[model samples]
Target: MKVGLFIPCFVNELYPHVAMATLELLEGYGVDVAYPMEQSCCGQPLANNGDSSGACDAALRFTGVFKDFDYVVAPSGSCVSHVTHHYPWYIADNADFQRLQPRVFEIVEFLQDVLKVDKLPKPVHFPHKVSIHQSCHGLRELHHASPSELMIPYQSRLERILQLVDGIEIGQPERRDECCGFGGTFSVDEADVSVAMGRDRVAQHEATGAEYIVGADPSCLMHMGGIIRHNGRAIRPLHVVEILTGRGGAA
Candidate 1:
């Protein structure tokens, strides 16, 4: 099946390697992946900021750019969640929107659910402690992991995917599903509150003695990585694709 690779604008600009890693990982599975150069934002920022007109334009552009693919996959859960759940606000849930809805998928869910990837085609040997950071959209919208409030038996698609690595040990934080405070435009509007939440998340991960904090969203990783560097902390923030592709991290 032909797949379209949708790299969020933040990831394309700030973390291009993550996009490359995602492409590499998918190509390894023998899936035909295409990256449309005309692609832009998924209108998440505009929608979050209440600019309905601007967001509608973006939503239309995104649909035109990616409508032909059988599946549109991105490494970020937030962007994918926005396209699947929020796009209907700007664009009608007509034939195009309905077809695109089920076709769009976050990389983790695409790999686990669609591809049925139990393990990597090539084995990865990380040999380090990693704490999983469940981003708000990934946790609540995509249902990547069972939220703590539900009080159900804990389960994580991210954790399960990481377990496939040869020597990786999973670390648990005190507050497992708390947000990193990088809620799209939320971080910029409330910088002080955002920094405080990020610091608290960093401290929680540090308490577990994890060397790396991994998650599906680069926005979350970027937020925590800045805080970790400023505080001279030992923890490293990594996009989950970095580990899965075994590229440019403590391997």
Candidate 2:
């Protein structure tokens, strides 16, 4: 299958290693993965900021760039959720949008549900105490992990994926699936509220005694990471793909 890698704009610019780790993880599975140079932002920020015209243009551009692939996989849950859930409103009459809607997936969900990866192809080891931070989009929209509010039996694709790695002990935070206060434009619109929420989330992760805060979404990590760095906290942020490929390092 031809899988197109949809790297989010922030991740592409700020955390290139996360993109590299994602590519490495997919390629490790022997899947045919391609990064389309024509790919750009999925129009989430524009849509969030009430720029409907610009967002619609970006939506069309996204479908045009990635519609040919059998599957469009992104490491970011927010972007995938936007493409899957919101793009229809932007490109309701576009055939490509309809065709590609069900084809896009966040990387963790892609591996667990679509790829059905029970274990890694090779023995991957990451001897670290890590905690899972479920992004709001990944938790609520994509259902990557069971939300605490749902009151259902707890389950996390992120934790399950981490279990596949040798010597990796998964720790649950006090609020296991809480948001890291990085709701794209939400962070910018409410800077004080965002940082306050981020500090609380980071403190919970630190309470787990985890050395790394591993999450599927880089946006959440980036938000909490700033809090950790600003406070001189020992816990570091990591992307799930990095742990899967044994590449988590100061990300």
Local accuracy by lDDT, each model: 0.91, 0.89
lDDT tens string, model 2, 51-158?
Answer: 999999999999999999999999998899999999888898898889999999999888887899988867788888998888889888988878889978877888
> How many clashing pairs in candidate 2?
0
What is the per-residue lDDT of model 1 for residues 179-198, given as tens digits with 9 covering 90 to 100?
88887778989999999999
Number of the top-ranking candidate, with TM-score as the measure: 1
- Kindly give the stretch of ten consecutive residues in candidate 1 with the minimal lDDT sum: 242-251
- CA lDDT, candidate 2, residue 83: 93
Q: After superposition, how far is residue 3 of candidate 1 from its true place, in Å?
A: 0.6
Report residue 193 deviation for candidate 1 (angstroms). Answer: 0.5
How far does residue 71 in candidate 2 sit from its true spot (Å)? 0.4
**All candidates' TM-scores?**
0.97, 0.97
